[model samples]
Every structure is written in structure tokens, then in C-alpha cells.
Target: MDFNKIKEMGLEYAEKGKNAALDLAEKGRTQAKIVNAQSKLYKAQRQLGALVYSLAKGNEENQPLVDKYIEMIANIEQEISDLKASLEPDTVIETTFEDTEEAADGTADAAAEPAEEKPEDDEAKTCPQCGAPVSDDALFCNKCGAQL
Candidate 1:
């Protein structure tokens, strides 16, 4: 009965369907099939809007209408979930850019600070040059030949 939520869910389904259709096109599927799928998705969204309006009118005998709307909403959610599951793994790497003034200030602060002594527990077992794990008794890294 929450019209806004219903509308939002409807829009979400439409977007997911659009994306799925586009994915099909990218994989060389027929244009007619994609367009047909898009048309069905749009119709479903419109039906959802109509259902919401009908349910909001305070008709006591509209329970079946409400139930149908709920079922449609669930179907849309499932479609979106399926589409998301079919997508390939994507990695997002984010890089931050600092203002020139901030960078210069940070650099100056770093230069003024004295290096801290390493903790006793933090022994140089790993290769400092390549960071490969090494034995505690090793005098030089076997992988990079760098002295500990």
C-alpha cells in the first residue's frame, strides 16, 4: 500500500530488465527478442503503478488486488537478483587525489619526523626488498638475494 516503495521497486525492476536486455544484445542476441523483453518489463512496471493506485483507494474487497501487487513486486525483485547473479565479477580500484598544498604539507611533516626503531618482535625474517617470507636463520633472502 506504500505507493512510493512500490514505485521504487517497479523502477528497480525496469532498470534490471533493461540491463539484462542490453547484456543479451552485447552477446549477439536478436534485437527483436531484446525489444520484446523490454516491452514486457515496461508493461509490468505500469501494471505495478495501477495496482498501487487501486490498493490506495480504501476498498475493503481489494485484498486480492493487494496480494497480486505483492506477488508482482516479489517477481520483480527475483528477476533483478537473477540478473545481478549472472553478471561477471568486477573489481573497483579507487585512487584519491590530494590538493597540492596538502601534499606539500604532508611531505614536509614526514621529512621532519625521525624514523622509529623496529619492534624486537618484528624481526627481519622477510626480504625487505621483495617482501618474500624467509626463515629466521636466513642471512640473505633466497628469492631476492637481499641481505636481512
Candidate 2:
């Protein structure tokens, strides 16, 4: 084999390897985004579900809130699918962040525009869904949507 030809083939293979590594890294990053976004989405849904269950117990009209959260979850799911399809270098991944304490103050209007979330942690509560730490009295798992 000619030395120059061997050098040329090595350079080509090295370039191909670099491109493949970059693609793999992008996929890994996209997967992390998907997982984190889905976790937040489930937390939001669980909180809203608890609220609805509470309000519904008192026979209060929570359909509007329920509908809103349903739409929000749908939007999150759509974004997740979009992010999955957007692992390319030119695509932007949009993730949604929702506050889990939206209903913590026990006000109807508190559910309005949510801010950033603060995750709760406790040693006793093992989430049946994701096995993450949660509060003992939690109605829903903070990490996942497991009914406790």
C-alpha cells in the first residue's frame, strides 16, 4: 500500500469518527432533555390531579383548571415529541417548567401562571413510580405520578 494513500484513508476515517461521535453526543443530550422534561410534566400533572381531587371532593367547579392542566400536559407531550425529533444540530429543544406549588397556598387563582419549581425531598417517602425521595404525606409522588 502507498504511504500517501494510507494517510489519506486514515484522515477520512478520523473525520467520519469525529462526525459519528458528535451525533452520539447530541442524541445523549436530547435524551437527557426528554427525561428531565417528562419528569417535570408528571409532577405538574400530579399536583393538578390532587387539586382536582380535593376540589371535586367539596363539589367545587374545577373543570376549568382540569381542562387547563390537561392542555398543559398535552403541550408538554407535544414538546417532548418535538424535542425527540429535533436531535439535529440545527434544531432547538423547548422544555416546559411548571411550579409544583401552584396550589400550595390553597387559592383558586394561585394556579395562575406558575413559576419555577422547588422539588421536595424526604427520606421516608419512596416513590413507587421512580423510587425517588418524597414526603410521607404526599398524595402524589413528586418524581413520578404514583398514587400514594
Candidate 3:
């Protein structure tokens, strides 16, 4: 009830708020780093695949260049792993090239599939580009981002 006690309580809450904000900011930065590293990892893997493919087709091989790409990709993977570990368990975002490729393939397959009959209510809608379910009021396809 005392004025001094209320002021001390207010200061404690303010300090807690500041700490929470700092923790959240740090998590955001870590998440961004993880995303950047993932992007680099994907590019390096793609390049390595291309190099191997070209070399195979030409009946040749460059072990040094291939090794370099492998090393770069490994380093990026380690960095991403470390960044993910730094994040809280619930906040971690894990991804793999296989998953991404599968998702891309799924999108392509969806787009190739034919659309089904519309519902009688007119509330149900599907994306013309991808055949994904969409809200009737949506202006763009949520799955394929095609304009509706």
C-alpha cells in the first residue's frame, strides 16, 4: 500500500518487460540467421548437384571443386544447426532440401491436376492454377499465389 513499495514493484515489472523484449529480439535475429544459412545451404547443394551432373555427362570429374562445394555446404549446415540449437525448443524451425523439393513437386502436381466440380453453396472454391482449396472471397490462391 505504501508509495515506495508500489514504485519498487513498478520498477521490477519494467525490468522484466525489458528482459522479455531483449530475449524476443535475440530470438528474431537467430531465426533470421537460420533462414539465411538455409538459403545458402540450398544454393550450395544445387550447385554441387549441377557440377556433378555436368561432369558425369562429359565423362569427367573435378574432385577438388566437388569437394569444395561439399565442404561449403557442410559448414552452412553446421551453422544452421548451431543457430537452431540457440533458439528455444518451440521456436526452432527445421527444414531439409528433400522436404523443399517434395513441396515444390506437390505444387507442380497440384497445378497439373484437373479441377473438380464446384459445391452447390458457392462458398467452396479452388485455385485454378494449383487446384488447392481456397476461400470464395480470396482474391489470390493461398497455395499457388495465382490471382483469382
- State which candidate has the highest lDDT: 3
lDDT of 2 by residue, 43-67 (tens): 6688677867877788887565566
Clashing pairs in 2: none
lDDT of 3: 0.63
Say which prediction, candidate 1 or candidate 3, comes out ahead on TM-score: 3
Q: What TM-score would each prediction reach against the true structure?
A: 0.30, 0.54, 0.57
Rank all candidate structures by their lDDT, best first, as comma-separated numbers: 3, 2, 1
lDDT of 1 at 142: 44
For model 1, residues 32-80, the per-residue Cα lDDT tens digits are 3233334434544665556456547655245554455456446544443
Quick one: best TM-score, which candidate?
A: 3
Model 1 bad stretches (over 4 Å)? 1-41, 58-60, 89-148
Clashing pairs in 1: none
Clashes, model 3: 0
Model 3 per-residue lDDT at 93: 42
TM-score of 2: 0.54
